[model samples]
Target: MTDVTTPGTPVSAAQLEREADITRRVLESFDGCADPRLRQVLQSLVRHLHAFVREVRLTEREWDTGIEFLTRTGHITDERRQEFILLSDVLGASMQTVAVNNEAYGDATEATVFGPFFVENSPEIAQGGDLSFGAAGQPCWVEGTVTDTAGKPVPGARIEVWEADEDGFYDTQYGDERVAARAHLFTDAEGRYRFWGLTPTPYPIPHDGPVGGLLEATGRSPMRASHLHFMVSAPALRTLVTHIFVSGDELLDSDSVFGVRESLVKDFHEQPPGTPAPDGRDLGDRSWSRVRFDIVLAPGGS
Candidate 1:
């Protein structure tokens, strides 16, 4: 047999196809990867990506467009905003991912997506401190306990909370110097805690990216239902990332992110006038919403 070689020549059709085959074959290299979980995740990702390509009959131009769209999404992000998270929310990826990891096992608090706006290291305020920071909105009092699956109180749990104002705007949206509608509190010995904050209002997810374009093309609205965000953590329990939603939020049925779990919604009842708050603050002449709920957590794994 005679050997034929074409040095520095453009790859032929058979050669190009062979290269793709080699790439796929190389992905199978992970079959022997050290970490089982990582191997499974990568293998599944590759399979789905390849399947999606075939299903969509994707083209080179379309792939380039996708890359450009992602680049633009990254370019638009700033300190207080994240377009990638926005993209995930619109595509239902964020909700689906949370649902997979945060199953409500035996009445444990249901987890939800941690939206892009949460600021870490928020100022710690005493129980019943006003998270609303005197902002104008329907007032609300939230009280709850953190407990283990056995119903034993989990004291010293930290509850980090944030929510939108009456107009559905976060304090960060207004560029405010003071932290409004956000606070951190610790549970008492009995695992009980309470705080004051504005009742949440339905708000729109940022709609100025590729995701927004997809929504517009599909004739979908971008509003998220009214809800309160909470990041609760304790010394020996799985940290919870979840939300308490207003029961009657108009957009609940059509939440943009698909994050409204029926079990997570509760009524925000108006407190009667002149009722004294547990913290001894006079709830005089003001309308307020009240939520009394408890959280359950799984035991630490072995």
Candidate 2:
């Protein structure tokens, strides 16, 4: 006896039958898809989309509005700004995809959202080198070791590090070809790596587009927690893209992209002014900080 009358507006049983028939026909049309995975995905997507339409009883005007919003999102996307990725991020789709792909195994570190700022063929640096590259921020000495989930060292792992400057902007945002606060380094034979980079400061995701409008309409913040980005890779090991958030950052609970994981937060111990550097490089009268992030990568097959 229960049907469309259960929620939304009361509708006749024949109306429900008509709507269901459309969904069924659409799903059946994909039965001839050449790819098995494509057919499965199409049918599943149709089922969920039809169910959503029915559940919400979406109005034509609302659908048109959504279409317009998506069109604007595409219009604002470019090589410098990936609005689609930003949209996926704000909707939690990126993190969900990351979660689905990066299965947990032992103490291996968790994965996180890969933001829109990554560039290919970053300049390589040696261990104990400065990654800051003259970017503006408090000096931070970052050191870590790369190991497999089995606790075995994975020497020569390539670790890519990048972060925003103190003014809450990446070097790319300066509208020039300069590369600062970003570099890659190889672990030593002992699987240890170190570099100098900025202590990450809180920043806003580029939110001036339709995605920003959506966030504003929903009463959500566009701020991300202070954190450092890392992309670690080695042969026979799964590549991991993640961030190490400052432990005491207030934005930890509310990163705009939902990229924060409890395991990824670490303490950045502050060193007083005139403190001796571990590598014997003079930090001068400037205060500095250090953090250790020992990474554990899962096997590639995982």
Candidate 3:
């Protein structure tokens, strides 16, 4: 028998066995890993990775290209930008992780991606206070209550909120020390909270880096639907990281990160100019928007 080969010839049985042996060897090498969980995860990862390589017959040049792509992804990441997370997001990995962590639990609010723009120690606002911080956008009144699955109020819950401005840029995108359009506030005794924030608006995920390139190459849009981000937590409730998207947003069906959930959409009622503000804050001749998002948290978590 001859080991003859052609440019597109099928892989020979002997060659397949050789590759399988390599995968087996790699798996066996982790037999002594002290952490059982780590070993299990790595072994499974190796199996899937090897299977993919074999199935695709990945070429050396292709592998080099992939390594270079990852290098570029890391180079562009910084304190303000997270290219890796963006990659996971566009590829649906982030959503998969979210789904696995957040299973159905009664009427608990569905969890979504914790986007890269969340800043720690955001300025705190009181109930009925303004979160806009003078950012540019139509004023919107946002009110909601924190409750458990049993419909009982969870008072004193810490709720963190943030969003992009009308122009689709978060405060961090400005490349300076400005914390506009984001804040944190605790719920009142009745587990009720309210604030004035910019009307949620559609925005593009940071698309000037490697993740953006991937989207362009794959013929996908980088624009996310308009949404307001929220992170709510209490003593004995699951910390919920989610978003409330605006109803009637065309991009809702095509959100770049696949973060839109049908249950998360809420109507942002339009308030015509001269409509009296709910909190007595003057809007002058400017039309505003308002929305209510009663959040139900699943019981049991730190």
Per-residue alpha-carbon lDDT of model 3 for 1-302, expressed as tens digits? 22323456577778978998999999999999999999999999999999888877889999999999999999999999888999999999999999999999999999999988899999999999999898999999999899999999999999999999989999999999999999999999999999999899888899999888889999999999999999999998999999999999999999999999999999999999999999999889999999999999997786
| Ranked by lDDT, top first | 3, 2, 1
Candidate 1 — which residues are off by over 4 angstroms? Answer: 1-23, 26-39, 272-280
10 residues in a row with least lDDT, candidate 3 = 1-10
TM-score for each of the candidates: 0.86, 0.97, 0.96
lDDT of 1 at 173: 75
> CA lDDT, every prediction?
0.82, 0.92, 0.93
Worst 10 residues of 2 by lDDT: 1-10
Top-down TM-score ranking: 2, 3, 1
Clashing pairs for predicted structure model 2, backbone only: none
lDDT of 1 by residue, 1-302 (tens): 22123333344567556545855886888889999999988988887786566445568999999899899988978888788998888788999999887766777888888888899888788977888776668888899899998899989998999988888778777765667888899999999999888888888887867778878989999899999999888877888888888887788899998888887898888777777766777767876778887888776532
Q: Model 2 reaches what TM-score against the true structure?
A: 0.97
Per-residue alpha-carbon lDDT of candidate 2 for residues 157-212, written as tens digits (9 for 90 to 100): 99998899999998888888899999999999999999989989999998889999
Better of 1 and 2 by TM-score: 2
